[model samples]
Target: MNPDEDIKGMFDCCFTIFYQLKGFGEEILEDKLVHKLIYLLPESWESKKIAIIEAKDLKKLKLDELIGSLLTYELMSKRLIREKGKKIKEQGIDINIIALKSSKKHQEDSSEEGSEDEEMVYLFKNFARFMKSEKERSKH
Candidate 1:
């Protein structure tokens, strides 16, 4: 798979989820899913959409929802890496598990025990690093 396609897929998946959540109800814009979508997004794209989404005050979204989304995306990314490992190995390619682990570990390290917002904030800050690493792996 091309790196561009993979990045586009990630963007499309999160955007679709975000849009659906946005249309669900008045408070749906404040959903943790929205935060996770924002968190997973690359810095390149965040600036364009974040202003629109952040215009809504969603500070009241429960901690459980926020953390849940973070964990869900983490698990999904891990599973993708694991599944792709087999194909890379079969092709005798150098696998970059370090990058994947670093991305996930960064999430775990940054997330505080009592807050999801903090974790999301951390993710937003590191989005560029994560995207670069994933793109490299996909190219190999």
Candidate 2:
């Protein structure tokens, strides 16, 4: 299999495990989750895999922390791939400096929009409770 395929497989495995475990009412033990995550990691992450395995307090690590690390790694890997692709495309061509700036601006805008959407969702979930409490206070 090619390197891209291997990376995709690793991402799929990690996301699947996260989705399965994240919904449970009880917390998954750190040791078991860590072992599973380490085992699921591809050889490309050799340094990280080694570091996680050799950590003195692997058992004490939280599941959320592990998941966050894995997610960040995945995002970084994807960004690197995108940058590499951009570099390849730029070769043997007159790169448009303005286009590059616009592309970066677009990425930043999209990220900000994502944060705003998350904030809206949080408010939507809590707004009803807040209104109910306000009504009770007004009656009392």
Best by TM-score: 2
What does the lDDT read for residue 81 in candidate 2? 89
| TM-score for all models, in order of appearance | 0.29, 0.44
The residue-by-residue lDDT of candidate 1 on 73-123, one tens digit each, is 556776998889888788775655757867787778774533677777889
In candidate 2, the residue pairs with backbone N, CA or C atoms under 3 Å apart (3 or more residues apart, or in different chains) clash, namely none
- Write the residue-wise lDDT of candidate 2 on 1-140 in tens digits: 13566444665666677768777754666687677766767677778778766764677877677667767777888899899779868774445575887788878799787889999999987998899999999999
Prediction 2 TM-score vs. true = 0.44
Question: What is the lDDT for 82 in model 2?
Answer: 97
**Model 2 / residue 19 / CA error / Å:** 11
lDDT of all predictions = 0.61, 0.73
